[model samples]
Structure formats: C-alpha cells, structure tokens
Target: MKKWLIYTFAIAILAVLALQLFMFSTIQQQKNSDEKYFNMAKQEYKIFVPYIPDSLELFGENVPVDHVLVRERLENEIVRNMYWHSHTILLLKRSARYFPVIEPILSENGIPDDFKYLAMAESELTNAVSPVGASGVWQFMKSTAQEYGLEVRTDVDERYHLEKSTNAACRYLKASKQQFGSWTLAAAAYNMGGGALKRDVDAQKTNDYYSLLLNQETARYVYRIVALKLICEQPFQYGFFIRNKDLYQPIPVKKVSVSSSISSLVDFAAEYNLSFLELKNVNPWLRSDKLVVNTGKTYEINIPLSFSHTKLTENIADPYTIFKDSIVVE
Candidate 1:
C-alpha cells in the first residue's frame, strides 16, 4: 500500500512540471515572434523630414525661421507627417499620380510651383467632399466655383472637374495676389476667403498672413503645405519607394463639347463608342445619368481615348478603366 501511494504522488508531480514547461515555452515563442515583427517594422518604415529651400518659405511672415513661434508651428507639421505613417504613405503614392496633372495648370496660370502643396492641404489630392458641400481635389464651394467660371448646377458640378477647378483656383490665386501683394497671403486667402483675408490684414495692421493671429485651420494651413512639400519632394529620405508601374498614371481623354440637352447620358456615351462606366470614370463631374444641358452654355465632356487594353475591339473581360496618360480638359 505504501509503494502504490508513492508511485501516484510522483506521477502527479511530473504532470504539473510538464504543464509548466509547455506554458513557458509557448510564452517565450510568442515574445520572440512579437519582437521579430517590431524589429521588421522599425527597419522597413521610418519618417524623415528633408531640407527645405528658404526661397519657398510658407508661413514665416516673410521672416526667417528663427522666431520661436514660427519654429514651433513648423515643428508641429513635421512631427504630424512623420508620425502619421499610413496617411503620409497614401499621400506619397497619390501624389505621384496627381502631380503631373496639377503642375502644368499651376505653371500656365503663373502661380508659384510650390502652390501644388496647397492641393495636398486642401483634399490630399483626393476627390473629397466636405460637410459644407465643397467637392473635388481643390475643395471649392458652390459660389466659389461659379464665381471663378466653373459651371455648378444640379446636373453638373464642375468643382468635381479637376481641370476646370484647378484653373478656377489659379484665377482666384492671381486675383488674391493682386489684392494682397504676396503669394503666401494669396494661399491663406484660398482657405479664408478673399474678403476675410483682406479684413484680417487691415484689422491686424500686418500684411503678412503668418503675422496675423488667425483660427486654427487657417493658421496651420501654410505650415502643413510647406511640410508636405518638403516631405513629398524627397520621399527617399522618408523611406518611400515603389515601382513605376505601381505608381498611379492619369487617364487619356478626348473632350467633346455640347450646347444642347441630351435625354440619356448612357446612350450618349454609347454613341461615342464609350461604356457608361468609362464615360463616368472620365467625367465624374456629371452627377446624374440624365443630361440636362443649358442651350447656350458649352460643356466639356471627356471621353477616354481608345486603348488596346480597353478598346471595344479587344475581348477585355472587364470594362474597368485604368488611368495611363495625363490629359486635361481645359
């Protein structure tokens, strides 16, 4: 009886020891796996801000970066971009696609090349819709779009039209510079309207946009633009790299003008040898299926230039369109 009892006690002690050993091994393996992942993340992704040109300064009151307040604001944006990893990566990817379209528009209108960053500040180069009803990559409100010669109606909102909207932005910037006498102030006015910008300049007795005490969004606007410009121009320093094929290319489109109303846009697109999706993809500004054109107004509708991949002649399994060439409808 004593021998049997001893055997039972020894077996129970071994079982407990084995269970503890298994638990420890599992925990150690998990810890190692987590460490490996963390190390990989650290090596693969890192954010770094590059050197910026003094001539292209944004929110410094035409003053240098020595001021304490100015330095702080700049630092805030740098930190924001560096830490907001996912958002910054997306911006980098999308910029490669959108910059080709935006750059020429800025140049033709004589707006500063640096103003391309304003698009990043506005909608991150996205066709974003704001709560106040602003739309498109440039984020123009209803009145602003119309006032700047963009057609805005229920059937057609040209604010969603990238080319026309960009041109409108250029006009506004030109007018603002004429009023405020500085490109920086013109950019600020783009955020806070021309009237408000003028009022602020007068009220503060300072012509500089950065010198005036403004609301949070307006105050941070220029700094954000400059930071993005710095980061985007030298993405290698920020650890961003992708194949050229992976980068987004723009679409090639042929513009067709119309002055009279059509019954169905779907049928109209078909007549032009375009699928309805193709028509909509090229002309996102067209908000409805039915066309209600004003007789006297000339509207530009973009049709995709036929390609071997998406041509009607090809046995393409899908009708989806891919943007390959940068074509503007201005």
Candidate 2:
C-alpha cells in the first residue's frame, strides 16, 4: 500500500510540471504577437506627409487654391510627384541636362520662366513623339511646328534638334500669350488649340482660366505644370534627392555645315571618324540614310568632340536609383 501511494505522488508531480510548460509557451507566443503588431503600428504612423502651401502662382498668375477643388488638385499632384520616386527622379536628372538649353531661349524670346515646366509636363524632357505626330520636348504637332518655321521634312526634320525646337516652341508660346493676353491661357492653348481655348472663352463669356470648364487634358494642364514646377524647385521635399554630379552633363560637340546633297550620310559620318549610327544618334533630325538638300537650305550637324571605345553611341543613363542599386556585376 505504501508503494502504491508513492506511485500516485510521482504521477501528480509530472502533471504539475506539464501544466507549467504549457502555460509558459502560451505566454511566450502572446508576447511575440504583441511585438509584431507594435512594430507595424510604428511604421504606419511614422511616415511624413507634405502639406499644401496657402497660396501659389503659375506664370505670375495667382492660383485659386483656396477653393476646395483647387486645394485637392494641388494636394493630389504633390502626392503623385512625391511618392512617384523613380519617374520624378528621372526627370530631375534629365532636367539638369535639358533645362540649361531651354531656359535662356525662353528668356530671349520674352516668354515667362515658368513655361519651361510646360516642356517638363509635355514630354518629361524627352525626345518623345506623340501618336498624333507631336514630336520633341514641347510635343508640337508637325503642322504647328512647320507653322512656327521648323523644317518638317523626310530628309531633314529640325523638330528633333533641341535648341532649334525649343526656339520654335518659344515662338509658338509667345504667339499664344499674345493672342490670349494671359500666360495662363496661353499654356492651356498649347494643350488644346488656341482657337479652341479662345472659342471656349468667348462662348462661355469668361476670361479666367481657373473658372472655365475645359476638356480633360486642357483642364488639368496648368495644374500639372504647377505640380512639376514645385517638384523641380523642391526635389528634397518631394523625396527626390540627388547630387549635382548625378545629373547628366551636356556633351560638347563641334558643328559641321552641310550645304549640298549628300548621297551617303554613312560616308559623311565616316569623314569625322564617327560611325553612321553615332552621327545619327546625336543628330536625330537626319531621317534617312541619305540627306537630300535643295537650294536655299543649309544643315548643321553636331559631332561629339570626344567619346570612349566602350560606348558606340552615347545616350543618357537610366537615372533610376533603385535600378542602379540592383545591378550586380559578375
């Protein structure tokens, strides 16, 4: 009987030990779960959001941001450009290369400084061609480019040349400013047409750009420009931070004049110790393999002063930091 009692006591001790272990494990699991939730809460609440400015201007005209719709629009763009790190950073880099070329042209033509942002909006400072044939930084249609004295031909298209195209854009914008009597409306005219904007103004009996109801592109046009203007000025505020050296530098080139018909552009490029692709890449205006030149026209082609054996045709770097970080060399 004493041996039986001892066995019961041993079994009771084992049950108590098992209960303590299970309780310890349950408490440890709950502690781990609490720590996980706490970390998530910290991350979510710690993010900083930019605030809207009380007042703003575009092309020297005051933005009616006090209005509910206007405030929402500005806030929307700030969020877009702020959070869109890759695209905006690319623009920030490209702007460093292209803005220097375009800014002085705007000043020379008596256009407002703000209009450079218009180019940023139109093409992201790229040599992009629109589906409707609007080409270059300013996205000018072929007919409009021709109307502004740009050569829109098969063999020689000046619209691709940065300086010449920017000058042409200045002319168009200057004319729009003249017709509209306000640079704000002038900008809207660029997206739609000056005729359309003017007709809408007259029919609606309003000259205020902010008050009129425009088609989607024209309506959001000025807002987009303003958004870009703010971001370019304050890149750090919008989360795009870059060193000055990170921006693309403009290549130095020497210009050669071609007056007569060139039967072979390949031979022309070879004369400068450059490949045909190199010549065409720098001067994208050269459309065909051969350049056909008639009387009363002289074309100038720019050749890079120096290049490395590594790159055949120089192009801008990708400028995306995330992509730059991911590259692993073998």
Candidate 3:
C-alpha cells in the first residue's frame, strides 16, 4: 500500500511537470509569433495623406481654398476619394467610357466643360436612382426631368438616356446659372432646388455660396465636384495608376431609328444580331421590354458594332490623351 501511494504521487508530479512544460512551450510559440507580426507590421504597413494643391477652381470660379474651412472641406473629399480605391478606380474606368459622350453635349450647350465632374458627383457617371425618386446620371426628379424635356413616362424614362439626360442637365445648369449669376451657386442650386437655395441666400444676406450656411449636402456639394475634378484631371498625382489598357473603352455603336413600336425587344435584338442583355446594356433608357411610339414620336436604338476581341484590343488607348485636345480646360 505504501509503494502504491509512492507510485501515485510520482505519477501526479510527472503529469503536472508535463502540463507545465506543454504550457510553457505554447506561451513561447505565441510570444515568437507576436514578435514576428510586430516586426512585419513595423517594416511594411503604411497609410499616406494626399497632397493638396495650393490653388483649385471649379467652372472658372476660384475655390476659396485659402480659407481654412474651405481648404479642410476640400481636403476631406480628396482624402475620402483618394483612399477609396475601389470606388475611385471604377470611376476612372467608367469616366473613360462615358466622358467622351458627355463632354460634347456640355460644349454644344455652351456649359462649362467642368460640369462633367458635376455629373460624376451626381451619379458616378452611371444611371443611378436616388432614394427620393430622382433618377439618371444627373439625378433629376420626375417633374424636373420632364420640365427639362426628358420623357419620364411609365414605359419610357429618358432620364436613363445618357445623351438626353446630359442635355437636360445642361439646360438646367444654364438656367440655374442665369438665376444665380455664378456657376458655383448654380451647382449649389442644382443640389438643393433653386427656390430653397434662393431662400437661404436671402435669409443669410449673402450671395456667396461659400459664405451662406446651408444644408449639409448642399454645403458639401461643390466641394465634392471640385475634388473629383482635381483627382480626375491628375489621377496619377492622386495615387491612381491606371494603365491605358486597363481603362474601359467606349463601345462602338450605330443608331437604329424606329417610328413604330417594338413589340418585343428580344425579337428586335435578334434582328440586330445582339442578345437582349447587350441591347439593354447599350440602351438603358428603354424601360420596358417593348416600345410604344405615338404618331409623331421616334426613338433611336443604339446597336453595338461587332468586333473581334483582337480588333477591340487594338483600339484600346489612353482616353485622357485621346480626348485631351477635345477637353477644354479653364
């Protein structure tokens, strides 16, 4: 019995020692892992604050970046867009495809070319719908779109029509400019309605957009546009390093005019050697699967031109360089 007790005590001591050794080993391994992780983090990780340009302008109006509040507001947008890699990268790619379409329309309307960035600010150059029922790249509400000559019907919403919406936006901006007497104020009025903006101006006794205390969204509106303008104009300087080939190329398309209704877009697409998805992609303005044309109305459906992958690749080039001559910089 004494031998048994002695043996059991010896076994218990061995078990405790084993457990202690195992725990020590585990603690040592964790310490080494932590040390390695700290070393790697110290060597490799970095976050950078972007440089702010001394001078900035939007639509020929000098942004009051000299003012501390103005500078900080602009910096906030720049930093947000700069660090937001996915969103900004997509913006760059999409701008390559859509800017070519928007620039000409703005020019023809005698609107400042800088307003293209306003469209970017509005919808990221996409046919986006807002929560309050504003739709399109310009984010025009139904009444506003119709007022500006867009057809916002049950079957057809031209707000999604890129060219037409851009034209409508141009008209609106021009009218806003006339009402406000400055492009900056016009941009502000575009975000908050003209009536609301005018009320704010009168209440504050200030015609200056920067000076007038306004709603949060309206206050930040122009700054966002200016920030986008700066980054788009100098993407590389802002740390976006998109290659020419990486940029989205504008799809080649031909217009098919139809005075009559299209009974089935699927059939219509097949007639043009396209899939329904492809047809819809090119013509998002076509709301319904079918079209109804009144006696005097006509619609133009865009049909993408067929090209081999090699041929398409051969046409890929830097949009900035290609459209540089066309872009009017003030």
Candidate 4:
C-alpha cells in the first residue's frame, strides 16, 4: 500500500511540472508576439520632431531672439505646431490648392509675402467659421467683412468667397499697416482689434507687438504665424511627410456669369457635369442649393472643369486619381 501511494504521489508531481512547463512556454510565446507587434507599431509612428530656429523673419521684419521672452515664445510655438501634427498636416495639404490663389492676390495688392502666414494663422487656410461667427480663411467677422466691401447677406455672403474675401483682407491689412507703422503691429491688430492693440501699445509705451504685454491669444499670435511659416516651408525637416500623390490639388474651373436665379443648383451643376456636393465643395460660399439674383447684378460662378482626388467615392479606389486637363467654359 505504501509503495502504491508513493507512485501515485510521484506521478502527480511530474504531471504538475509538465503543466507548468506548458503554461510557461505559452506565456513566453505570447510575450514574444506582443514584443514583435510593439516594435512594428513603433516603427509606424514617430513623435516629437521640432526645429527651433535662433532667429526668423516675417515681411523682412526680424524676430529679436536676443530677448529671452521672445525666444521662449517662439520655442513654445515651434513645439506646439510641430507636435500638433494632424491640424498642421491639413493646413499643409490645403496650401497646395489655396496658396496659388492667395499668392498672386497678395502680390497684386502689394501686401507682403509673409502675410500669407497670417491668413494661415487666422483660419488654417480654410473657410473655417469661428465660435463668435467670424468666417472664412481670413476669419472675417460679418461687420468687419462688410466694412472691407464684402457683401454679407442671407443669400449672398461674400465673406465665404475666397477671392473677394482675400481682396478685402488685403485692403484691411493695408489700412492697418498704415495705422500701426509695422507689419508686426498690423498682424497683432488683426487678432485683437486695432483699437485694442493701440490701447495696449499706448499703455505699454511701445509699438512693438512682441514688447506689449497682451492677452494670451494676441501675445502668441505672431509666434504662431512665424512657426507655421517655418514648419510648412520645411515640412520634412519637422517630420511631416505627405506623398505627392496624397496632397490635395486644386480643381481647374472656368468662371460662368449668371444674371438669373439658380432655383436648383442640382440642375445647374448637372449642366456643367459636376456633382451637387462637389459644387459646394469648390464653391463653399454657395450657402444653399439656390441662388436668387437681382437685376443688373451679375454673379460670377466658378464652374469646375475637372475634379481633384479629394472626392473619395467607393468607385474611386485610387487615392491618386484625378481628372486630366479641364475644358474652359466660355
């Protein structure tokens, strides 16, 4: 009996050891698998690339990095914009389409090239509407847009119209530059009202935008613009990479004059071989599917002759898919 009991006990102990060995092997295999996946995922995602320059310029005006606060402010902006990758990437992609339109307009109006950065800072180079009803790439408040000759109405909101709004922005910038005597101050005024900027300058006894101790948004405004300018110009340097195929392209469109109401934009788009959704996509200022025209007032409607790859229909499997040369509508 004692011998039988010893045999049973020994066998049970060996079985327990075998079970433990099996579990150990399984657990180790799982750990190895996890490590492999972790390494793969790590290779896919990168983090924290920023290039903080010692000095920078905007419209031929230099940021005096010699000042500790100014240098620190710039450093803050560089880090903020660089790591905030998603927003910055969208802005970069949109720049391919919008910058061509904005550049020529800026040059034509005698506005400094650096002012394009200001527009980017204002509205991310998009027709983004603000919390307080400021609209468009320029973030024009309805009142201010009207003051600059942008017609704001229920039916026709020109603030959302890119070219018209840009012209208005140039006029406003020119006026502000005349008032402030410096591009820096002019940009600062754009954010926190010319009156507020003037008050701050007078109170602080300085005309410099950086020197004036202002509110947070106004304070960081110039630094943000300058940082964006640097990162966008050298996107690869800051670890932002979009393949040429993935970048958004502008659609080629011809101007169509309309002196009559468009009762149904759906029908109007079909006439031009465009989708209703796409019509709004390019002409965002068209608030509704209908347009009511007044006598003697001719509205220029931009009818796209070609489609860009931005339209992501299921049939359009290729991300690089884009229409060839557009036919200009006479």
Cα lDDT, all candidates: 0.75, 0.80, 0.85, 0.82
Prediction-by-prediction clash tally: 0, 0, 0, 0
lDDT of 4 by residue, 58-175 (tens): 8789888789998888889988888887888888888877888899999999999888989999999878899999999899999999999988886778888989999999999999
Best by TM-score: 3
Q: Model 3 Cα displacement at 69 (Å)?
A: 0.6
Enumerate residue pairs that collide in model 2: none
User: Rank by TM-score, descending?
Assistant: 3, 4, 2, 1
| lDDT tens readout by residue for model 3, 131-235 | 899998889999999999999886799999999999999999999999999999999999999999999999999889889899999999998998898888887
Model 1 TM-score, 2 decimals: 0.73
Worst 10 residues of 3 by lDDT: 321-330
Q: Which stretches of model 2 miss by more than 4 angstroms?
A: 1-47, 307-330
Model 2: lDDT equals 0.80
What's the TM-score of every candidate structure? 0.73, 0.77, 0.82, 0.79
Worst 10-residue lDDT window, candidate 2 = 321-330
Tens digits of per-residue lDDT for model 1 on 1-330? Answer: 999999999999999999999999998767753355445546776545544444546532353466668767876886788668788878876876678888899899888788888988899888899999889989999888888898888888888888888899999999988998888988999998888878878989998666889878999988888778767766544444432333445566778888888789999988988888889877889989877876577888888886443343244222122112221111
Ranking by lDDT: 3, 4, 2, 1
